[model samples]
Target: MSTPAAAAVSSADGVAWDLADLYAGPADPQLDADIARAGERATEFRNRYEGRVAELDAPAMRDALAELEDLSQLADRPLIFAHLLHAADSSDPANGALVARTAEANSQVRAGLLFFELEWLALPDDHTEPIITDPAAGRFAHFLRKGLAFRPHVLDRPVEEALEQKSNTGSRAFKRLFDEITSGLECDVELPSGPQRLNESATLALLHDHDREVRRAAARALTVTLRSNSKVLTYIFNVLLQDHNVDDQLRSRGHPMQARNLANEISQESVDALIDACAGANGMVQRYYRLKTRLLGLEKLYDYDRYAPLEQQDGRWSWDRCRQMVTDSYAAFDPRAGEVVEMFFEHSWIDAELRNGKRGGAFSAGGPADAHPYILCNYTDRARDVMTVAHELGHGIHQYLARDVGYLQSHTPLTMAETASVFGEMIVFYRLLEGSRDAGERLSLLAGKIEDSFATVFRQIVLTQFERAAHAARRSEGELSTERIGELWMDANAPMHGDVVELTPDYESWWSYIPHFIHTPFYTYAYSFGHLLVLALYATYRRQGPDFVPGYLEMLRRGGSASPRDLVAPLGVDLDDPRLWQRGLALIGDMIDEAEALAAGRD
Candidate 1:
């Protein structure tokens, strides 16, 4: 049942990003000068419009918004630089200090300008509607309208200002500590060559090794390290949970996910429908895993075995091959997407090297709209890593195109944010699938795609469910023990696998390392939302042929100028329909069916 292990591909070993576009380095003198200039702008903004926000006419409101947008982007540059540096190497004290300084500085600037939002929030619907509809409001119209949703939740200017200023040393500091601790973890995994110490990314990467025992070793090593740091990690979790709860209570929000729902510009009912639909489709998940178990030739599948390759070959992808394939796939879709993707590779905007102290996982950071987005990923040369590159580049493409929307409106909500990335991944995925040389290779590709979909659609729901349970536990049961949280994690995960996959005891602690739970609570569901949305959209593309390209591209270009519903409406899709989500599940079912048919052909 074992596949042959291939030699590791080191093609990406020297692929480091050049960040000089952002700054010369962390110690660049201009970093402070930019911060100071942003600070001065904030003070001036506050002095100019502190008490006059509610009384401003449409033209005056438009001018204030433009000024705010300009200052906001200026303030964001240094903090973005600090964050990117710290992510590249959190172990460096200077990088860590820079993050702290920049964050505190940004917090002070936000505090100084807090009254603008508060005053706007205090305005009545009658007073705000005219300004939102006025031609004089210009590009700020959508931004103005979006602010109305926060009217009920916003605190008074003074309290909001204090909370903003104190967050640097409070929840923000603890989140950074968690990052440092997890990023610094060194897992001592035993390899056939010898005992090798690897960082979190490398350790996680080994879970896909063709050797099952190596995967088990990597899994156990991760568990042991996580257990060793359970005390601090658990403490950090509890503190953040309480902090979030306190904030929710202060803002008079009804539930744990309400704030996130509002921020995503989605209805609570729609999110409920999404989660409910996914939960209802858990039968498809268990069925797929059962099929996976049969294909892997195992009596029962373990959690670590979930990513096992069906083919005899390890299927490693070199960085050069990955770039060519991804870019060619994008180019086949549209020349513009291909060109946008090339810009990332051409400008050295990606940091793909595997190294100690680098943060685990992958992300495409959309810096200030004036500058381009930068990507960070651990490119281990696996087939899955190729998809990761496509996914992040999808985000980079969206961020790059949306710059025309200006800084304030260019960023989409988390719900719509994943649209481009997931779509980009599908474009590459189907391209690879189309070129499959044989039934076995086709099945292998399908299996990989199905598992990835499960991870995106089903696993994210589990994470969100776990967050809900933990938040509720922290509130009702007081401080939670590590065992209690572990139990909650298991409870949330149980429905997804059912009897098909046996989740080992060690899998409980696996939840400890997820950065999203620490960085942004309730952020996990957006993955599911975006994935299902893309699945449906991809189906539309398949059906419509060449006609679908322009609408899709125009949708991305629109950015967050409109609500998520309005933004995607041009594509002739309904977000609120329960059946739309079911269609996505049906597409997943079709993938599993195709995989099963291919598996039978191999016999």
Candidate 2:
């Protein structure tokens, strides 16, 4: 196990990430210069090889792929910069405008490069296989294979370019509008103490408050604020939904979600099985919520009390304590994992301040393949916030390990993307569990981990079903009113609760705020996929003991260099096995069983 190299770890004081490594700031003149240079490079490449990528021999093919990778990195550097800036402060018009410009610039460059993929895909297997399969192709094999997978649904080059160009002003614009409205929202929750003015992050943090009244106040605050903005958000969602429908239609896809399935490199059977497995286990969601209700002394759980904490003490976790807990947890798992996480702390790669206008939720976006990835989260030091750090850092560490694979191959499908993150979180949860000697604290720890699992597994899969229903409704019934969308949500989600909890009308527009539904249709399933994938992977880690660390690390090291099935086959796991998912779900059932035993003793 790689150990954390001896060094001075710093204070966990809340800090903004220093993007000086990427650029001085948004207005840095070099940004424009880089964009201009990238544009010139794109033109040069187009002029050199526009209708001719497939004609190149093995060595030339390697060079072309290498050159294309370099060109891509250059072209998107500004866009990444803009993306990070907007994530830090979505309410800023300057950042928003920069985002649009960068998107359009990226589209133009992509349009120029479309012919390369088109020609590559156009080649017969006999013509292209030798080059793609060559040992020298290295990581590029999987990249090319993935590119070719889209051959079945690819449009003509001109049409593809047209869609790319229109996206900046069309769907992309609507997404930005959604972001601005949400980021600008300020929820006023009247507490017993007084009125608390909350940003999205703070308001969300209150949902887990030990006090039921505070949780209710926060939930309603979010509902009222979002309901006020529903008209515009509703329209934006409709346009984006129709946009996806039109894209799928023009691509001649078999259904609304085939494009995403292809993009994820997952078969429809595997995805459907995963969804069905989770849906069938909806009773488990109810069971867990029922446990939560008994623990909280409630007759039943309202949607507001879904995340309410069992502990009544002020759980204001210090940022410093969070850092120590996560770092130590990673170290306990493997020094190597800790070492990678330490690099983020030492180099200032995290953005964790809870400033107004910052994007809600959290993410870890990889920078240029050679540079470190950046993490963005609006941290409020809640216990959940620590898990959020662990989660995002999992992504960071994964990106860090996979960096050597180069940009083109460093991108994992969303299904596998959550592997490191969820595992990282589990490491921390286990560490916390192991350290807890008191039964009450242990119960709290176990319940929190279980709830997190449900959020990832059952909750996300439910969200995916909601997406499917909403898409079907929009396509068959014409435009859906906001009320109609809420109905779709209730119909899809109510069953997951299975009478274990209550769903209020507020949850209707709740779907409206989920960025995934707006930005990436069918992306929700991956969380369910990833969560269960981690549990299965963690089981292997347990059976093999420390011996499993290398296999796990090697898996991360391989990154997107191989298919998901091929990637896990070496670990003695099968992505296609129906029993694999059931085993993972069974583990969750086991946890609940133990929790019940503990609760019985407590009484």
Candidate 3:
């Protein structure tokens, strides 16, 4: 484990992303002036085209979009910078305040410009045709398509403005309250080093400890903390659900999930199919857990043992070694990708170190076309940490390439967003697997990668199912009791793990620690979708070798401009087919088979 001091140095060692590139800093005089200037631009835009959009010709319409893009670009930079920094270190009250203020300012800017797109969408297809034909409008195709998709839900200007205004205090406020309450919980766990306060992330790390006592203590502490805070979380859930219910009714959306599907730009059918496939693979997951039980020499495997390290190994890789491993893997597959990823390490773009008050987990944010993407991670030199570095860098490189398309089109939907990151991880994992010289190392590498896949694909599906049950129960009746939530979580996990792993009574409350449930409802399935898609894609790459790079890069470049089906069609991958998902599952099955065979031979 990395010392807190080392983690702090890791946090500060890199440049920590020059959002100053966006605006010098929050304290910059120019940044203050730009905020004022953005307000001026919004006023100018409304006055110029608010009620007159119908009269504009193709050239005028194209010019209007260009102007809107410029204004959006200006308003977005500081807001992005503020939010990125805030997410990087949420424990800082100052960063949190900055995020709140920036969100409000951006919402105001959005409210001001709402008329432009609303009016634009009201125009007839014939009137919009010439605008679409213009070379300048090419970049706005994705934006225009999104605008059209929302036409059914788009309201009159006054109604839209009212919704926007209410949003800050409604769902957004509840989200923040939930985050604060959850993050504030301090789990006092007794460790070898003595009793200490552990945040959610730190407590999660304890699950991987070789000592079962530590894992059990962490689990119990987590339950105690969440149970204490259940009332607050219940209130937060009720408020957010009510907000969603009202919004869905207003927009005439069929279901809450329908709105999410629309936002993801994926059909409900696709999600349903994906979920079904995951459900069918529960047995395979059970088998893997059974193997893990034997490997760990446990009489009965508990939920906490899911992530236990193999053989209590203290293997740690330096940051330098991790960088080389990831880059070398990428280079082995595609030099261009390797070259792009190398820039992140070389130019000090990533903040990859764990520290207190720093946000937990890993994410890539802030590639707003005008600036390079920045990644934040709590790196601790573990093998998993290396995989995370590759994962995030994949997102950074994808953002870097898509930056050429301009801001609106550059942002991919959440479903497709995971494609590159997961693929990057596979690249590194496979390279390492091929280089393993001994059976023990090979088994460890394979086990680690499979565990990651199961977590990403299988575990996330369980989460999605859990959320579905929780929301459904809430909507049909009312707020769920803490016990009720735990029961629902257990229901989702029981079949997924089967009889191989014992779901202890305390394990049910594990859902309480999952930030995704609070932060993004039903968002967990996207991880599963992305994982399976990448697994299948990686399988193809193994067969086709270097020939796959161009097709993959082309998909990345398309970004949000194309749908998932169109993006993957070039590589002959069809997401709509259940069999494609099965292919990914089959690959996972193969890994399990290999592991079983190796263990049998060793015995």
Best by TM-score, which number?
A: 1
TM-score of candidate 1 against the unseen true structure: 0.98
Report the C-alpha lDDT of model 2 over 195-274, residue by residue, as the tens digit: 76777777888888888998898899888888989899899989988998888888888888798898789988888999
Error of 2 at 95 (Å): 1.2
Work out how many backbone clashes candidate 1 has.
0
What local distance difference test score does each model get?
0.90, 0.85, 0.79
Off by over 4 Å in 3: 1-18, 124-136
Residue 423, candidate 2: C-alpha displacement in angstroms: 0.6
The ten-residue window of minimal lDDT in model 3 covers 2-11
Candidate 2 residue-wise lDDT at 277: 94
Clashing pairs in 3: none
Scored against the true structure, residue 160 in model 1 reaches a CA lDDT of 93
lDDT by residue for model 3 over 162-203, one digit each (tens)?
A: 788777777887787766666456676766666667666667
lDDT of 2: 0.85
